[model samples]
Target: MPLCSGYMAPEYAMDGLFSTKSDVFSFGVLVLEIVSGKKNRGFYNSDHELNLLGYAWKLWREGKGTELLDKSMGDVCSVHEVLRCLHVGLLCVQERGEDRPTMTSVVLMLSSESASLPQPKLPGFCMGWNPNETDSSSSKHDESFTVNQVTVTMLNAR
Candidate 1:
């Protein structure tokens, strides 16, 4: 499957390579979105000048991870579990495919409270915006495409 600019992993977006790791990346973004109640795509924080992932990482590093939680949950949610979800999300979004945990590992981490989790590196899309930086979204890939004029992508994992 061709990659969409948003939610596409570096491997797939940069080299047209699609695999389970690519899905892991997308799942990470989804987890972040669910936890923070924000969409990864079109999520721009002006103060930090970062996308959702970068902003979450920023909060995490500053010892303000709890602030990243959705306001509606408030004091009702379990802080430790929420933090673990964030940790797992970051692990799944590491820049390299090899750095990401498999879905099996992810499920285990999410399920077992005693499971030890490795610390996550910064994250992909960390430097989302820079005024003086040269950036372009116009890859050789089209903005979006259709298979037989159908908008949805259909592909099987190896």
Candidate 2:
């Protein structure tokens, strides 16, 4: 799938540099989005301007991470499993690419219940649109981006 530039790692977003770690960062964002059933972009909270990552981080830090789960999936999933996924997702979106786990590590972390995962620092692009800014018409600090569509297909081996 072709993701918007919003999912790009901070280094790649700012410096046009990308690597495997960038992919890790994107994966982390995906994981968080999935767990929350929310898109990283176009997500708005009445309480604050926090995007999905910021909101998730806040909840996790406040010992209310379970509230981040999508209510539609109520009673259909394991709280422990969901929290684990949330943790793994946060780890993947760490501000520094090097802080993110490799794909191999991600797989293991997701699959192992006993794995000791490290706490994630603030994620890249955690801030959302700040409505308090008076310069809405100015594009100088605009984070607005155009979406590009790309289709991906995977063939299964029998």
Candidate 3:
């Protein structure tokens, strides 16, 4: 979606630079979608590319974020609780990593009703690719190293 929208921010998108905040942003979007039963990437409106995140932000600023709640939830949902979750999600997606809350803080916020929340900054790339293939490459490297070690051990024994 980043590539398609041309909205990929240079810091987080092209450089493969990401931090916990990046995960936070993703988590925010995920939570929003879960609550609203909407998809962020595929959302469409005649006037804007405003995905679920944008739409939620708009509603939030307008004091109508509660309106974005999934109609299906009906009376089961708490308006204040939902708003708090949405606020925390937005804080997670702040454009600058430093501005985002750590997972620890997020958990605290979620669990503690009295916790003070920080104001959220504008969110980073609304969409992008995952560049962390290190886990896959590390496994391949480990296999190669094991093979090399076996070859050396055999030669020494001979």
Whose TM-score is greatest here? 2
> Superposing all C-alpha atoms, what RMSD in Å does each candidate have to the true structure?
9.7, 11.5, 11.0
For each candidate, the alpha-carbon lDDT, in order, equals 0.80, 0.84, 0.68
Tens-place lDDT per residue, model 2, 2-119, is: 1224588988987888989899989988888888899888675666567888888889899999999999999999999999999999998888888888999999999999989998
For each candidate in turn, the TM-score is 0.76, 0.79, 0.70
Model 1 clashing-pair count: 0
How many angstroms is residue 14 displaced in model 3 relative to the true structure, after the best TM-score fit?
3.3
Candidate 2 wrong stretches, greater than 4 Å? 1-5, 130-158
Query: Measured by TM-score, how close is model 3 to the native structure?
Result: 0.70
What are the per-residue Cα lDDT tens digits for candidate 1 across 55-141? Answer: 888888888888888888889889998999999998988878889999999999999999899988867665454334333443455
Ranking by lDDT: 2, 1, 3
Question: What's the lDDT for residue 19 in model 3?
Answer: 70
Q: How many residue pairs clash in each candidate?
A: 0, 0, 0
Q: What TM-score does model 1 achieve against the real structure?
A: 0.76
